[model samples]
Target: MKRKSWMLGVLFVLVILVSYMAKPEKTQNDLLLMNIEALAAGEDYVPIQCIGTGTVDCPLGGKTKFVMIGYSLE
Candidate 1:
């Protein structure tokens, strides 16, 4: 009985961990919406000026490690 309970507890923990790990990461659209919301909230917004296949110098100034796959305006 005790061994069975122990195995069930382990299985429960594993399910929780797997669920957490399998959670979908935020997508570009999500990020864009967040940025829009931030802008509407009167927060500072630093738009991405440019993107490259790899790290490249931003036209604004410093270097950036962004590779923009797609973008949408409003």
Candidate 2:
């Protein structure tokens, strides 16, 4: 029971953090979405982007290389 409660608390914290991180100020588009994913080592990964605010521009379907050596250091 104790472990279950602790797990629940942790999950609650995680959800709160995720929501807090995603929460952004109101902009012109009414909906702004941002997604970030870590690329796999030695593998090519593409970034999925959605633009809402006109202030910043993002490249659609952008690709980034993840080197194993560099990722381990960070």
Candidate 3:
């Protein structure tokens, strides 16, 4: 019983670790939405723009430009 419980605990931890590591990194849109949310909450926000070709301008303002690597807008 004790060994079974230990194995279960280890399995649970490994599962959690693998899931965390496999999680996708936040995208530009995600960060933009977060900034918008913060702005809605009366917090200061500096808008960012996309610098590469086929880039979409930030709705808020063009304060900073960023290139979304490995992402294409279709």
TM-score of each: 0.40, 0.33, 0.38
Estimate, for each residue in 26-50, the C-alpha lDDT of model 2 and write its tens digit.
Answer: 6754232222222224345444445
**Which candidate ranks first by lDDT, i.e. highest?**
1
lDDT tens string, model 3, 34-58? 8888778862444444564444554
lDDT winner between candidates 1 and 2: 1
Query: 40, model 1: CA deviation in Å?
Result: 10
In model 1, the Cα lDDT at residue 49 comes to 56
Error of 1 at 12 (Å): 0.4
In candidate 1, what are the lDDT values of residues 1-74, reduced to their tens digit?
A: 99999999999999999999999996678889988988888634445555544467665666676633344454
Please list the residue runs of candidate 3 whose C-alpha ends up more than 4 Å from where it truly belongs after superposition: 30-74
Distance from true location, Cα of 17 in model 1, Å: 0.5
Model 2: colliding residue pairs: none
Better of 1 and 2 by TM-score: 1
lDDT of each: 0.72, 0.54, 0.67
